[model samples]
Target: MDAASRQDADTATPEFTLRSVLVGLAIGCLLCFTNLYFGLQTGWISMMSLQSALIGYLIGKTFTHPSFTPQENVVIQTTAVATGTLPLAAGFVGIIPALSLLSQETDGVDALKLSWLQGVEWSLAVAFFGVFLAVPLRKQVIIKEKLAFPSGTATAQLISVLHQTPLPQPDGLTRRRGYEALQSDDVAHEETRVVVEEDVPQDVEGEVVKKEGWADLLYSFGASAALTVAAYFFPVLFAIPLFGTHLAREWLWSFSPSLSYVGQGVIMGFPIALSMNVGMLVGWGILSPLAKLSGWSPGPVGDMATGARGWILWVALAVMVSDSLVSLVPVAWELVRDYTGHGKREGHEDDEEEPPERLVPLKWVAWGIGASILLGTLLVWVVFGSDGIKSWATVIGFVLGCLLSVLGVRALGETDLNPVSGLGKVSQLLFAVIQPRNVVANIVAGGVAEAGAMQAGDLMQDLKTGHLLRASPRAQFYGQLVGSAVSIVVTTVAYSLYTRVYEIPGKEFPAPTSFVWLNLARLLRDGSLPPHTGQFMLAFGLVAATLAGAKAHARATGASWARWIPSGVAFAIGFLNTPSFSISRLIGGVVELLYRRHLAKTHTPPGREIRLIIIASGFVLGEGVASIVGLVFRTCGVGAASCWGCGTGICAGCG
Candidate 1:
């Protein structure tokens, strides 16, 4: 090749260095613990791509030997995102916990007991299939269609901005000179000053408030972590009696002071927080009392089979599933319209062939997908037993999972929302007809589909980032492989460790999403709805569907009142957990509203919103980390009973 041709080839194919892959793997494994902590605490999983990218850049800066290019950082980020998704993909937060809850309800008739090796094998079997599934679609979905994957595009922008200037000097000379210039009056007044003043917010007295982003982050993190640890020792801190102890225990009315829930609320914002509290009041205040008065739920408050918790679980699941399915109509309509050639396109499809070197070999994808399917089937058969899920059913589930992944990716690309849970519900409904009365089969089958959707959506986003950076798809794919392998081990171990220490469905880790899955499995297994459940479910489902439709209409019409409409999904989630969680979220939501509506009325700070996010993220990370640390203490023979709030009469229950 000529010199110009060689330059083009070099630019097209950047080498994936061993150091970058290792860095990515290491970052990814650590985030696996953090993500699982968030996922189980709430249903949300924080994306770590931006965080990973910045961390990787810092690592490269600290280590002067091996240079880390933007392309290599892309690899690191891709690996981290892939591994961060493993907790959900491996069924740790949702399906596995749901299974455990099922076992608890059934008195261990059908318990899911997997050894460490089996856990790793099960995770690997379900996780990698989605990576291979996204390989062939890169050219079509990412390059040609050019669908805007918003998260991926945002990560790319951040990377580009980070690399705009050359790296700073290693010694203090260049940095000192720059800092000195910023402090000078003449330099500050210059129109084109090196430091951007727009980012610094002014206080009430018109004086510049020096940025304390790191300080704020550390303070919030420390406070949340300390609260979590302290709550462990003084269990009374976990619950505040809203009414008397009788009402607190019997009616389940108490305020849970949890920093983690407040942190989650800050990110979720006021509307969702409001909706969740509304749902909580309806479920706990209205429904629970009515059920008990009418004797529909005759058992104690905590009884899963015949109590208020179990009864409301079905209603919440119905509402959530209905809302998700109804919300999908617009996206599905656009897809159908486009496919039929009735919808508008950016332009006619280009028939020009893409460069051969840029494409992932079709043969490789085909082989990988085939292998994943076979392995998944074999593992399902071996682990779940032939009596649980038949071989044909397992194969069918995998096939359906792969198909649903297409829809999942499309939804993610267009709307920045992956309806994995909805897709899993669809899978569950399908199995309800095909293989009814098998609780294990129902849950496992849904898990298979959910895992595929989660992994596929995550990988596609990473690939979109890679595409934007002009990074080699092949290299990123390799990084994804390494990340997936590492996550399969790390996430499984983390899940096992947490489950051993904390009760899955208990206060510390409610696993709300797991309850949804568990209730649905129970419905399918017995084919007999609980007393008053069918009626209540139908009522909640209709309400959820209506609200979803109205929200969509309001958005289409640009109605100003749209923000007032509560999210059906968020409202339903309120019924899945205790009232205390919603109360804490409400507190955070009120604070967020006050800040946005009242504070910074003159001119909002550029990085003010980011500072709030940092605070929220810190709170979540601190609580999660504290939980893991607390697990270590327990393992080292710390008394679990000391953590119980039994001595405090305010909580009503004693050990």
Candidate 2:
């Protein structure tokens, strides 16, 4: 490449134009739909982003050289990754539409019915609104203070890997000799010595620069396949035995002397499934046993298990809202600094590089916010009411949602309030104050809160990536719009299919419900806590563990602590997942370790590509396959009888 081209490649702005954003959105939507369809068919939420990223990388490599500008590279890579992953997102989207159709025939379809069009519309509007809301807050959270939004950190690391270039060096020249020459008094002598040193610089050509290879592909494929198979044959077994072993252990231990064998069996069988086992031991085993002894079978706790009352639901909503509110403080501060004159500092030109001019001014943020509220109101009107009263209530709810979201952004700092549990608590508190009559409203409210939070969090991460690559803010904003829209469609579809095939008589499909609704219900009704709180505490307890893990990740693996934290969260969550999932993750972890230790041999290539493939493919296949199997079993008239052998079986007999 010529010098001008090279300079352009190096210094060119990362321009994610309206066109690129639209393309990304289109790709993201397509992937989401495909993933949703497959997820419903098979029960796997496919890894759309993973596939997109890998494909994008390959395409970029094939068409361009490593010397390509980072901006161009990101555009090509993101496009490819988005395309590859679109199917998964599509699959998720398809789930809701599928379920909505199925709910017409199913009895007690209250929980099952979700209007796909409404969901999409609201998701788009709110997601768009979230981007505007997030922009003002970015500088505070990301730049000013650098509160560790670890996911953003990981994205930055990934970008660095994708953009990094190596320069050739001359043959060996020791630093000792160079230092001695530098110490010489004569300037001419030093200049000559420097030239000589440059002429005989150290040779680094033989030194390995790690790159992704066939092994990564094999590992990703194998791991995804294994996880899919495990989720297929034994869901419940996958659920409690592997994922929620703590609950299972507690149940078994409840029988004490009578079921000692069962408890022993579990411990001996799945040692890695510790979090759930511990949780169950504490919640069901120890707590229940003690409750019985004290004659304190709290009506509230029982009610929570059987069905959440309206008051309980409200409380959950309150908790979720309140917590989210609490978390937005830092984020809001960041926004003021970025857009307005509030936080400007003298001689800070280095920090405030001129943000490119935009068609939509800061005033447009208010317009977007208004549009979001209007759209949300329309959705509520369609879902809950056609009458004027329902219309008014829906409007009120929409306004409330927007206000809550804004307040949440202002108070909480950034949106990643643990949606299942944390936001549920906020909703619960609000319900208590409002005295809402229907439990479903509280549930819906909480879902909205979570969706908002999730969208906000995602927007922040995307912006962070854009900032690092010097991509235009508008491009990042649009890309998110595309991604969220597509992802929602996929999620909806997958959810729909899974529910249809695996509708557990009285229960909703557990996965979505578990993370989203049931856990919230648990918190609101019983004031119960999630396992993450314990894990967070445990992180503090094990300083050595943190240091060791972080160091190993950074030094040995060439990954930052930011990556480790999320991975650790995934691992902890995995421990709470089905045994099959834990087993799959364990296998994946082992493979990763081996690759790092034996194969890579201290020259590790970026694992993001491999991980993206495995995680995306595994999630998609697992969910998709499981759904298909459920449909087949349902068609065959093999109800609860089929699930008897292993608790993971799909039999609805117990209910």
**Top TM-score prediction, candidate number:** 1
TM-score of 2: 0.58
Candidate 2 residue-wise lDDT at 252: 23
- Please tell me which predicted candidate would have the highest lDDT against the true structure: 1
Query: Across residues 1-655, which tens digit of lDDT does each residue of candidate 1 receive?
Result: 6645643654564557788888888878767887787677655565557556655765675574655777888998998878877887777878878777656455224577677777887897797888898887666577657766656655564454344422211111121100000000000000000111322321311111123544666788799999978776666677777666677777777787777678766656677678889998999999988888799899976566688877887888888788778767776787788779787566536532335575578898999999999999998887778877888898888899888887777777764657777889989999988788778888889989878877887788788777766677888888888888888889888988877776775656767778788778777766678787899899889988998788767755868776578777668767867788789988877776776565347455443444454576567667877877777876786743453545434341122
> Where's the lowest-lDDT run of ten residues in candidate 1?
182-191
In order, what lDDT does every prediction score?
0.70, 0.37
How well does model 2 score by local distance difference test? 0.37
List the candidates' TM-scores in order: 0.84, 0.58
